[model samples]
Every structure is written in structure tokens, then in C-alpha cells.
Target: MSPPTAPSWSLVPDDLLTEFLSLLPVKSLLRFKC
Candidate 1:
């Protein structure tokens, strides 16, 4: 069977977004997102 792909933000757990947010720069984060 094929392996699963990395879960995207919408499909991921809350803590996943939390961890992702911590790694990004403020300016880039703002520009890239809403």
C-alpha cells in the first residue's frame, strides 16, 4: 500500500499549527497568510 502524505494544516491537529507558527518569521507569516 502507498504511504500517506504529510497532513496539511486543515487536516492536522491544533498543536501542529502551533508548532508551525513558532518556526516562521512574523513578516513572512503575515505575507503568506491571512
Candidate 2:
């Protein structure tokens, strides 16, 4: 059997995603950047 896959970010609306990302602190964003 195959393992479950992660949900795709493509399913999220671009504007909503941008807004969410903007709300994150710079430290948190830096962690994700790596």
C-alpha cells in the first residue's frame, strides 16, 4: 500500500496564502526558508 501524501498548497487561494504568510513573524518565516 502507498503512504498518504501531504496536502498540496496549490489547493489554497494565492491571496489567502500570501496574507497568512505575511502574518507570520520573521523568525518563523526564516525557519521555513531553509
Candidate 3:
């Protein structure tokens, strides 16, 4: 049997991701990006 695979966040929709990111403060988001 094959090994179990890890779940990926890539499966999340771009719009959903954008919404979450938009909820963060500009400074916090900038720090996270870096």
C-alpha cells in the first residue's frame, strides 16, 4: 500500500484566501509576506 499523503492548503480557493488576508492589518500582512 502507498503511504498516506499530507493535505495541501493549495486546495483552498484564491478568493477565500484573499478574504482572509484582507482581514489582517497592512503591517501584519507585510510581515507575513516577508
Candidate 4:
């Protein structure tokens, strides 16, 4: 049996997500595809 799939690190914490994204490099952030 396969394990359940988990959300990726791209799924950062709400506040932290925004904070992280705000600080992410343009190239790396572009890979997020919004």
C-alpha cells in the first residue's frame, strides 16, 4: 500500500508563508507558479 501524499513545503505557514514568499529569490519563487 502506498502512503498518503502530504502537502509540500511550498505550503508554508500562513504568516510565515507570506513572509517567506516576500523574501524568496525571484528565480526560486517563479518555480512556485503562484
Please name the candidate that would achieve the greatest TM-score relative to the true structure. Answer: 2
What TM-score against the true fold does each predicted structure earn? 0.39, 0.47, 0.43, 0.35
Measured with C-alpha atoms, the lDDT of residue 33 in candidate 1 is: 92
Tell me the spans in candidate 1 whose CA falls farther than 4 Å from its real position: 1-8, 26-34
Q: How close is candidate 2 to the true structure, as a TM-score?
A: 0.47
lDDT comparison, 1 vs 2, better candidate: 2
In terms of lDDT, the poorest run of 10 residues in model 1 is 1-10
Across 1-34, the per-residue lDDT of candidate 2 in tens digits comes to 6754745776789999998888777769789998
Worst 10 residues of 4 by lDDT: 3-12
Residue 33, candidate 4: alpha-carbon lDDT:
72
Which regions of candidate 4 fall more than 4 Å away from where they truly are?
1-6, 9-11, 25-34
State the lDDT of candidate 4 residue by residue for 1-32, as single tens digits.
67547667546678998777777787576788
Work out how many backbone clashes candidate 2 has.
Answer: 0
Off by over 4 Å in 3: 1-7, 26-34
